[model samples]
Target chain A: MIPLLKRVAVILAAASFAGALVVAMLDLPAPTVHLPAAVEANMAASGVAHPVTAVLLNFRGYDTLLEVGVLLLALLGVLAVTGVRAAPRAVAPAEPAKRMLARLLAPLMMLVAVYLLWAGAIQPGGAFQAGAVLAAAAVLLHLTGILPGWGAPGPRLRVSLAAGFLIFLAVAGALLARGALLAYPPAQAGMLILLIEAGLMVSLGLILAGLFLLLSRDSGDEA
Target chain B: MSASLAFDLLLAAALLWSAWRALATPDIFRAVVLFIVFGLLLTLAWARLAAPDIALAEAAIGAGLTGALLLDAVGALGSRKDGAP
Candidate 1:
């Protein structure tokens, strides 16, 4: 009886959800924008505006910066933990089928990463998106032995690791000194986005690559 | 009701199902991988729900970094189990 009651309850819940979904689909509104007068005026004033990118690198710039910092610090921690002391794991060779696919996709992956970074300055894509793609590519390359680990991160790796943070902080500081913490260079908003976005792409990619180094290799296991 | 709202509901349901399965799975490793899948689904949900910034962070920190950490922890756990007499 208890089991039967539970089954009934589940059926009832599923039925109710389906009913609501049907109602929602029927009532779906067409796409429309009706901004208030003040916002409309503001948009007009900002003739050359990329609102999404602006929001990403200026309004919520701090959050974005910190997010990158988290990745950077994570890599640093991993490097310290496993750089020299920890014995490196020998990555298993990729299957022949996968190797061919990876090689075929490599150039395309590189192109997409570059495109995403370049587009971020003027359009929808940005550093984080591009960096993630680039990192995936790096992981693939590492896995295929196209770029083998040379034991311990060298001096170049150390400096490259912090490049994004150093660039972001210094530029933001200069901006703050002049006017606001990430304010455009007196309406050079596009350029500011470009600079930061470019720097972020490099930083994000390196940081992700560092995480790969930390974990050593892609091992199939659960936490 | 709107297109975005409909999309959100769909994504939410998917995310919930993944999370539920992740918790129920007997294999700890499978559970962790499911959790990462849950994160990915949630990131897509965020995008549909009009929070691309949140989605970006979710994919990077939540799915990417967190997944890597879980894999690392799994290795540590495996080694420890093996080390035990």
Candidate 2:
């Protein structure tokens, strides 16, 4: 009787909360400050044809920079908690069908990643999406035994992992020296954004993939 | 209502139902699968709102990566419980 009462109470609370949210949505007033028009007006000066890219990498660059830093920090936290040194374990070969799928898909995914990065300047894709696709490819390969679980990152691996954040920081610093943070010269903004995205794509891919690879190593140990 | 509005309403209902089931389900695997369904529904919602960028990100990172991670965790938990290789 008590359990049923408790469930009824919870459901009633949830229903009321959802109803309130719907009411709030229906009552929303028109915004006085229209951001899209403002963004459109400045698009030419923002150095990217895509409004979303312009805002993300140019106008609100600090947010993106900090986001990258946060991701790197999260990876560091995971490494510290797990202990950086991973014992190497032999992985039994995956079934032939799985192996073939991984082999065929990984390269194609890489191509898609590059395309997404390039398309960000004009379209809906960007470094985050591209990096995720790259990470997904690595995870698929690891699962299929084509790639091994990570141990302690080598010097080269460490550099690759930090390269994107460092490159982004360097650009921000250079722009800061000019006057303000991430204030790219209009003429050079396109090249600079592309360079940062390229670096970010590689680093973000490694860091995201590393999160899985590092954790999976412990599971592999027990198996 | 217009056909698009009707479709949007149906989508929203599915999203809410899936979210509720994902939380209330007894089986962990079924909950995770429902969560993935919720993510896909969210991706569709984003696309319907004409925010293709967010939709793409939701599909890849929110659904794909997160689903894989959750499934992996479930596998690890199951193995530990069974004490089987």
- Native contact recovery (fnat) for each candidate is 0.17, 0.43
Q: How many Å off is the CA of A86 in candidate 2?
A: 3.8
Cα lDDT tens digits, model 2, B7-82, are 9999999998999999989888999999999999999999999999999889989998889888888877766555
The weakest ten consecutive residues by lDDT in model 1 chain B span B75-84
Residue B45, candidate 1: C-alpha displacement in angstroms:
1.5
For model 1, the local distance difference test gives: 0.71
lDDT of 1 by residue, A119-163 (tens): 665555677777777777777766775655435766887677677
- Candidate 2 residue lDDT tens string, A1-223: 4599899999899889989998999999999999999999989888889999999999999999999999999999988987876455635679999999999999999999999999999999989999999999999998888898888989999999999999999999988898999999999999999999999999999999999888777775554
Give candidate 1 regions above 4 Å deviation. A1-49, A83-90, A217-223, B2-10, B52-69, B72-76, B79-85
What CAPRI-style quality would you assign to candidate 1? incorrect
Q: How many backbone clashes does candidate 2 have?
A: 0
Regions more than 4 Å wrong, model 2: A1-10, B82-85
Clashing pairs in 2: none
Full-model lDDT, candidate 2: 0.91
